[model samples]
Target: MNIAIVASILTVLVGLFYKGHKNWLMTWLQNFCGSLFVFSGWVKAVDPLGTAYKMEQYFAEFESTFSETWMSFVAPMFPWLSEHAILFSVFMIVFEIVLGLMLLMGAKPKFTSWAFLLLVVFFTFLTGFTYLTGYVPEGVNFFEFGKWGPYVETNMKVTDCGCFGDFLKLKPKISFLKDVFLLFPALWFVFRHKDMHQLFSAGVRNLIVGLSIVGLTVYCMSNYLWDIPSNDFRPFKVGENIGIRKAIEATAASNVPVLAYELRNKETGHVVRVPYTQYLKEFQNYPKEEWDAEQIRGDQTITVVKDANGRASILKFYEEIPAEQLSDYLTSHFELTGDTTVIPIATTKISDFDITDMDGNEKTWEVLQTPNYSFMIVAYKLYFEEGQENRMVYDTTYTYDTIAIEGTDSVYVERKVADVQARQVSQSVYDFDDDYVARYTEVVNPVLEAAQKEGVEAFAITAYGDPAMIEDFRHETQSAYPFYLADDIMLKTIVRSNPGIVLLKNGEIIQKWPYKQLPSYEEIKANWMK
Candidate 1:
């Protein structure tokens, strides 16, 4: 049944129930929406940077989709919006949580109802656009359905909508459908907002919600600004074994292909498609005249896998390999090589977890696959824009000039001309809290020295950027461990701190710590080294 029809039937039933038990139904609806909002906001609040990154993805998609048309007027603004994505992320999360609290407490029901309606409407539009664009290919007008080919699938630029953060990923279609269902309650609250019952007095309810907003805001800031999330929801979280995940991925990739094969005859130019199993079965005893004349065509593989939105996709592959050489090819390409081959059967979470040295040498397998404990210090960026230093440079030059007076004919005089030239100078500055750096050095240096004594490896990984900046940081801190390079996004995924610590043992994440939580040398020696 259509969602609208279902919603209409539910509304009629709800109306009938309200006639008999209006107070109970209104209270129930308020609590239900309030709980949902709280949950949604809490997940986002726990990982605000994740939400910010999602926002950046949305902004990038928007810019990419609208950059070359009449909508180009808004294209330039996306980069700026992406830059401040974290600020918007923080505000939205706080607002949602506070609104949830207000609704639950029945504080300012009139305002709450209006705000809720507006929020729902905005979300409905967002999710609607997200769903409709699946059919709209790139560089085509969104509303021009005639130009859109058959609605085979979503060609959406932004994949995940980031509605429930990392905890729950909803597909564009499902997300749109969910918003449609939510509209019923939203409309209900619009008309029956006054039916909301207050849990406390006006002053007490205001104070409660206000305190909640402040408390959650502080909690989010503490996690994002100063340290890693108290709870890690990523694939690299502690206790996850990379080797085991690799094995699972390998198994998934080894599944049989879902597509059959088509072969064309060289002499007759006739083509025939047969089931993959049947083709393999007949290959050995096939007649030489027919078999030798057969040329593969439309050979492909179809694999089904679930996306982040939990939607199954019939992923197609067009690459072809001869059946006779397939076994040899697999052995030569995948068996000996350490590189993991991605198949369409499943997604590997840690596929992109790689490490490289400054010279562009990969050391991922060496560090992660070895049966030893290692300390990886992650620093995403060495400098912040806010820490940049500006200076003005003034230059003075003297020049001798000859000029003739108006009344005097051919009268030339030597005069010294002074010119003052000013130029703006700017330099990247590292203002990474000198006291924090000092404390970090004090705690980490000893641990590194002890790890060396115990034959355990330790190293620092940062994004590929200015070598001079890395050298300066190393020299200033007098860090004993070697510093390697990795992508900043990878470092951020490793830990949500400028400088964080990750303890890995044989590709399994053992523990992770923020800079402020770095353990002492004695503690590391006693617990980890052993």
Candidate 2:
């Protein structure tokens, strides 16, 4: 149907319903839904790629689950969809914002109402699926209620629904519940769309919507195309101190283990689990010989550690026990599991921030503990293909071959051949665009030079990649700072930009700058160094 005809019909329907006292109620509902969507769309628009990553996660989990479930018919398509997640992300963000504006203005109420309902229905399906999947564990069919046994708190494949992007990470259950609640309002709009009130004249409303669409598009594009987010919401954002965070994490991790001791009756081969505290209290008065006669079957301990900064990392520590010495060791150490295993739990989100040099040596702690101010240049990858000229240098080797042949007569003939051997070679030189290298060097070298002049430390960090490529990058760019390796995801979490700069003072992030916004030496000294 033509949009103009739809708009005309919606305008007439809304006008017919406009002569009522319930205008205030409809306006209020419209604004409420409009604001909710606007906020959701705005957060995602600022970091579309972040939403894309979340979409990829959902798609991956869906692909895996679908392959095993009865939904195997559509399993192969999910991976392909995941590959184009960014495109879907952009479409959703724009659709949401446009719908929000239409709702707020009460423009084309009939169309907006139906569109909103359809969108909400789609969201409800996704969230509902996500919530239900949490109960399904590996090796068990999704529909097998008997095999599910009990409600096991298994790890979910897709933890957050990404409904509000990174701004709010709702659990799968909460996301599903939220969508369920939104259904009431969606249905209300479907029936009462005519009661919606227009806030402005038709021309003004159209202009506002047009400008909003253009402005939001430009804003999103600017953030994604050239630099990091204008506002960083990540845990490692500026002003966060890594050293203090680690210290706090360590302090929080110090917890007593909850132990359960298993003892087996050697004669009957019967095993029983006893609480560690009760066992210790009871056995304090019992005979050691009697306890030894009953073999120690298993020992299990559960410990909980919380790091307030972010997610906790669990570390399990185990110890081996000999059957002969189990009783003696348990009495002394008090760390025996049913199977003589000792479990120590410690968790931290910053564990993956571990930095390593190209040689695979850890340098994370050293870098964090440096006394002098440090400058870190993070480039997740040295992203340049071997342009035509250097393609052969990276893949081929030139060699000379000599061959001798006997003629029919008695004479021998020698032949020389210029043989081109096809084998991967370490490319010392790369064919990266000079201007691109120069642009980065111009921004980064001065900062490194300034750090050097002031006796401060500076280094470049990148994800694990070809050592030869890194060496070429260092040489071609004339980088004075040393380069180190870290996980690509870690580098991205540090800063959104490909080649961002982070200024740190004793492991505390003092300032950060995307490539386009890197400050000069004087500017840095004036604004941040003090």
Candidate 3:
């Protein structure tokens, strides 16, 4: 983090104090490197909530263009990724700071230069793609750089490019142009310097870089750990549009103001107002003995505190509960009958009529039911992940065809499948559902369950826009095990594989299997009965 400061000092020295015509070249390189850090830093620094909101908005429309396989991949993966968004943010911050510092200190010159150059190239490509495809309808037009190309513009509007993670308030046009401009220094950083160690020496150089790094580190810690955004840009700033006090007053006057109150603790006399609607269901009838409800949303309160330019956050005031606490609460409340104990077993299915294999002889598909075996009826939803948007479009099956099986159950499944694929952002996995289904059925499910099953029926549960698809699932696997439709995430979390299975004893899970492996009846019975 302090690397930014080191880079800043080096930039000033090179631009102003350095001797001879060397100043000219040094100034050019310095400004170029400086711009990379300043601009990228700004992009990385954008308001997280605003950035996330923008990304969410894009996904809303993006999800429509994907194949069935692609759609299932995204929905589950996106939420999981978003949950750890802070980790990504931290990584970005450290990356920018270190890169900037390395540039200033002239350390690992070739490697650093190449890395920054590559970064610039990537950004340039992404920005260009965004403009060309119009996938991200917001942000400035990078295509304009080309003298006479398809200036035949598609629909686009003014929105933050989020180049810096919505950290700065720069307009999209400015952000786009600025990022493009920084490519010069990034290029120089790669080409100019031969010996990296010359950039930093044993004495003064070390002190300057070390001091700068320390300062930046302190600044970052103060802002992130203390929940303080830059004083100049924080919402609490004098010219800021939103007001915390006003928000609080608004909440207090209305019964349903999307705000609620909660005590910091039974022992402390602290109270806070939050968007009440967010937690209404969670604490509507909460038994306070075991827990407590607060009027303010935790995130909101922290945001407000930071707005106030407060040094320590209200988060410190509140007793924070670990994630496991919530997990425990959910499990206790749901009384989820799935295996609380670890047992290994897998499920396998075989389509008796081997139409693909051209086995003309009549074959009976067997469904075996045993009291000791756990039964799981899996329904698959195809969601695409990232890096597959174009591929999904070209693949055709995701959008145009019935994602599931046939005409009777086709239309709804098609629409739902397409919708899921269209929702992916870059850096995410794509065509997840298709991959899941293919992998499980072709490889995992079959390999582990080579022994033919008898009297046990398997059915996939999924939803299309129509109720009939679900009904069809019921019809297809009639009177076997009930096909349980679950929220897409629940299904993924239950098993990392598609068409997941569970061994049940009296309707409770005794064993679970991932897609890569399925257990035989004997294996399942051995694990569960004990």
Candidate 4:
């Protein structure tokens, strides 16, 4: 593992330099752990929103678990946590970075040691839970082998624990093991807190600690609270071919999980527990008769882990293998009466991305193939403002008006369906948060109009809102372009800007601009779009 390699190198470096000291080993361990903590925390700080989203996912998962049991009293807290996930993320990033600094400088041995141990304990529980979830009988990754389950990790973030943010995606097992390894050093730091050597006098160390806390908190806030992340590590970073990235869903073999299957006969009430396999033939016949394979041990039930109820859980073919190929999937789902394991297939980092038009047409490929320069206006959510700032202004719909022109009564009346812009807006200027309103109206609208006139088509893709609300936003903002739909998470990943602009040609990202830093249409056409 990379962590192990880094630890080894640190050990050699620290040992060689500090060997003259009486307590070199302690120093070495402290340095290694401190370095790791800082790096980990910094990566998360790079895009605090990403961490916020992951926390939301975990909170939702926890909510589900708590709701399932009689101890449902605490379930409400998870929802609250989900709502305030961004705040939690910011604070956690501050703590991790500051704590790591404290440990490295030996700022306060007793305090730092206890904090480190507690942090480790919390992280271990999280990773441990995630790793153990793979064994869930209903979990797609359950003993499926060969490949991780969708539950193993969400393309390293959304579904996964996102410990290192987008910088790295260690397998759940690896993550759990890494935390386990850290337990030893953490315990030692607690028991032998006095042995830790301070790098400077108390005043200097105190000053450093205060500076670090303030600096890191500000840095983290700058990334999410006020602006887009300065660094882009996601696949959608500038210069990536999104078409090719999304295409990996079908072609990437690296993440192809061992084909897992669960089959049951509703008529006989007989449940067949089949071991996971990639081979279609082997998977199909396993229940009826013992199938051939070196991997299968004596007694299929013994080989597979039992469900929570202790009955060997049934395995269904990993769902999401494409509809045409799902002869077995359909068969199992309809013919059998068991919990159909819905392990997400192709839920890789790039696989789960898609965008569709407001009319419900999948326009992902169409957008990818759009000729010449194209602009994507991403608004993870769109609304005028909060509180009394917003009001409905339904714009574009009309009913037919019929009239007799002459004094003589004319029985006949002309009828027609009329369409106009449907919208809503703030009733008063006081209701507007001028900053956001200006971005969409002053910046986004004018730029889009100029781009379209220049033969560069622009489209807005939004999640976190329904079509009606989106229409209200578009009309309210007087947007010149059309809007589409995508997963909110995917939209957030595509660009950190809440309403960011990304330039593309033949599906490759040419450049990106946060709402605050949007370039003039002339500036873009002069540079690359033209």
- Which candidate's TM-score is highest? 4
Q: What are the lDDT scores of the predictions, listed in order?
A: 0.70, 0.70, 0.43, 0.71
TM-score of 3: 0.34
Backbone clashes in model 2, listed as residue pairs:
297-338, 298-337, 298-338, 298-339, 299-337, 299-338, 299-339, 313-347, 313-348, 317-344
**lDDT of candidate 2 over 1-530, digit per residue (tens):** 14234445544554566553246556666767776788789888988877777788778877776787787999899889888887788788888988988987888889999999999998897787677766766677655666643233354566567788767677688889988987888888999998888767789988988898888777776766676777766667787766545543453344344466555554454556677778878765434433332223232233322245322222341222222232332334334433333344233335468788888898887888776688988887676667433344323444544444455344444444445565544434467666568656787787778768988789989889878788888888989878999887667767767688899977779998878788887788899988
lDDT of 1 by residue, 212-268 (tens): 889988988887887778777776788766654444444455444445655555466
Q: Which stretches of candidate 1 lie over 4 Å from their true place?
A: 1-25, 125-133, 136-155, 254-348, 384-446, 464-488
Question: On residues 349-454, what C-alpha lDDT tens digit does candidate 3 reach at each position?
Answer: 1111111111222111111222333355444454434343322232223444445556565454333234332332433333334554464455434523432254
Summarize candidate 4's per-residue lDDT along 1-530 as a digit string, tens digits. Answer: 46446656755664566533236667767777887888899999999999998888888777776676676798899999998998999888889888887877777999999999999998997787677775454533323345442332333322467889988887788888999988999999999888776676799999998898899889998987677787887878876666654543343333344434545453454554555644365655544444323222221110112344433222432322333323332343233234332222233455656788777889887888675889999888664543445666656655666777677767556666577665667643323346777888887778888888867888889884556667766777888788899888888888777789999887778998888778789998888765
Q: Indicate the residue-level lDDT of 45 in model 4.
A: 94
lDDT score for candidate 1 against the true structure: 0.70
Q: Tell me the lDDT of model 4 at 365.
A: 79
Model 3 backbone overlap count: 60
